[model samples]
Target: MGWHIEGTYFENCNCDSICPCATSGLTAPADYERCQVELAFHVDTGEINGIQVGGLTVCLIGDAPQQMSDGGWKIGVLMDAAASPEQAEALGSVFGGQAGGPMAGLAPLIGEMVGMESHEINYSDDGRRHRIQVGDAVNVDVEDFVSPLDPTELGVRVSGIGFPADTLAAGTGTTATVDVFGMEWDNAGKNSFSAPFAWAA
Candidate 1:
């Protein structure tokens, strides 16, 4: 039987609407002048080949020219600092496109592999407060959506996600930028976003 891995991930890109890459579009340039994405993954129930796995997070920072599929892509993966060597290896395997799954399908389109780093991922949601951060280079905090009455709040929800609903996102800083061949972009945005597939580890 085919394997199913359930997880959540948040991506920040420099494109407007949905990133072209996700929809198999390679037109002009991506909507945003620059692009930066911080993806955090939590693998709940899954296995790669035969290795049992637990929670793991991967952060990807990349740059692509307007049209996705054009090619050039620089990517870096951040793993949970607490994982063991086996876990780390598994993380790399899954994130690196070696596991032969939905993500691996994109491997051929990716250009730069910035390697993988170990980190500690902490995500929490308290009533109306939500927090997610990766080591230090990336961080996201969301509060009740403004404009709503005192008792309730309404902001923006990513098209279909539930946890990070209608929240504003900010970044600490961008450590690097990449663009080459087909893919190209400079990712940098501190705006509110709501899109499908924001959380899929």
Candidate 2:
């Protein structure tokens, strides 16, 4: 069986400007602790073996405990409500650390399934900027990068990886966190990145 899907991805980490690890080639915390990135993806144009899949949301949990290599990665997945059984299985497999693609390579480091959350997702694009909402779990809103000193704006770019997303993100009035495999994540940022990507077949 074969499948292909196209859509956009968004992510925000606890790292400071430039997320040093991405370019500086340095490990997280540059000392003892690790760096974590909570990535949320929305599939605007998606399909599985010819099935029309739209409005499906998924998230990825990434980290660089010992730099890029040395493995030790963990990932958590969330499936949309509209997904059928087959679609759910496909998504689970692809995101559950199977297939050995970009995410697959990081599966070995997964700690555990921190459980999945079913929340409403709202997205809109007004050409110049885009907006995303996590309903109840969390709220992710971003317009565009203009200036660096701007209080509610973050000016940065990551070329292809959707870097420098949401110059300023404010977490809603909630405590959203995921802890597993000795790793803990507190969703506090209100802005993230949205980009398109594809894994191996």
C-alpha RMSD of each candidate structure in angstroms:
6.3, 5.6
**TM-score of predicted structure 1:** 0.64
> Which one is best on TM-score?
2
lDDT of 2 by residue, 53-124 (tens): 666777555656646445555545556666777767766766675633455655665655655544455655
Total backbone clashes of model 2? Answer: 5
True-structure Cα RMSD, model 1: 6.3
Instruction: Report lDDT (Cα) of residue 154, candidate 1.
Output: 48
Provide the clash count, candidate 1. Answer: 27
lDDT of 1 by residue, 95-140 (tens): 7777655567568868878666676877544434444566655565
Best candidate, lDDT: 2
TM-scores for every candidate against the unseen true structure:
0.64, 0.65
Report lDDT (CA) for all predictions. 0.50, 0.52
Clashing pairs counted in every model: 27, 5
